[model samples]
Target: MAVLKKQLEDMRGIRYDIASLKGSISNLKTPTARQFVSPRQMMTNGKTPTKRSTPNPIGVGPSCISRKKPVRGNDPRKSAARTKARRRILQGKQISEDMMAALQMEDLKQLCSMHNVRYRGMPQARVALRKIPGLIVSDTEDLPNRSATGEEVQGANMEDAQSVESESEEEDDDSSEEAEYFEGPEASKDVQPSAH
Candidate 1:
């Protein structure tokens, strides 16, 4: 009796499953026949769905896509020549000694003028002028002889020379006065004076 009851239960479960599957099938809506295409037919037709025409080939269309003609009179040769000339000037060799000396003198005059010093004398001027270049000289080894008297010819203007001389004299006087003040009787004032 128990075996018969179990068999009846199993048949009822199978019937429920079949009814649910049938409901699911009936609820599904099939697509129309025209919506489907066979792969063989599409391949045989060799037709592609049309796409919108591409935007007109950018800017001036296909007409301006050709190579542009060269501009007239736009020669690079003149520019090249100018560049060469500039290079030559920049890399040119040093000036001769005479020219260099003259330039040095001119530079000295300008410096002197700026400093309110009167630029004068051929010999003394040259000596002083030589000193000007030395101011710019990087090497002490290149200094002109300090004891060279020949370079001190009597060419410097009298007034200018006197000024330089008086300036030196004044400096000397100041140093002497300082020395006397430091080393003279005043410096030893703390000590008793010696009897005459």
Candidate 2:
């Protein structure tokens, strides 16, 4: 009878365990009033809920390429510098050496970009600025000096032509006089010696 009683107790325990197991299984099938993390979200290695590592690595890793994002436009600061440089170019103003020296190398590069100047790498700003003025002067040698305008050049040319024409007329008069001197014998030949 004791053995039967012990068996009954074991059976009751087993029944209790089965009931608990059934309850847990049912709860797993459909969790009640719980936050749902989708399968895609769970696949993202969910260690930190707030912070995630960015795809852009620190510095340039081996696999990484250019850091400048294509989506965003050019750096505004550089574009501003380029606009300033372009304005100066359109005005035909010389870039002052003092300003060139004061500006950063990047700013000078922006200036060069405005004028379509290309370089292998970052060149010396001062040297490039100095070269620009000389280039302007050399290329524009055909243009008359600032003091000599179109009217002044026309006046000078007119005066030169007048002087040349006057000089030529004077030479022709002198040549006519010399011809008279050489024609003395001819003039005598034309006159009869005497009406003998």
Which residue window of length 10 is worst by lDDT in model 1? 93-102
Report the Cα RMSD per candidate.
Answer: 26.9, 25.0
Task: Summarize candidate 1's per-residue lDDT along 120-140 as a digit string, tens digits.
Answer: 654555355345532333332
| Candidate 2 worst ten-residue window by lDDT | 135-144
For model 1 the TM-score comes to: 0.18
lDDT (Cα, 0-100) at 113 in candidate 2: 73
Write down the TM-score of every candidate.
0.18, 0.22
Candidate 2: where is the Cα deviation over 4 Å?
1-92, 120-125, 134-196
Position 192, candidate 2: lDDT:
33
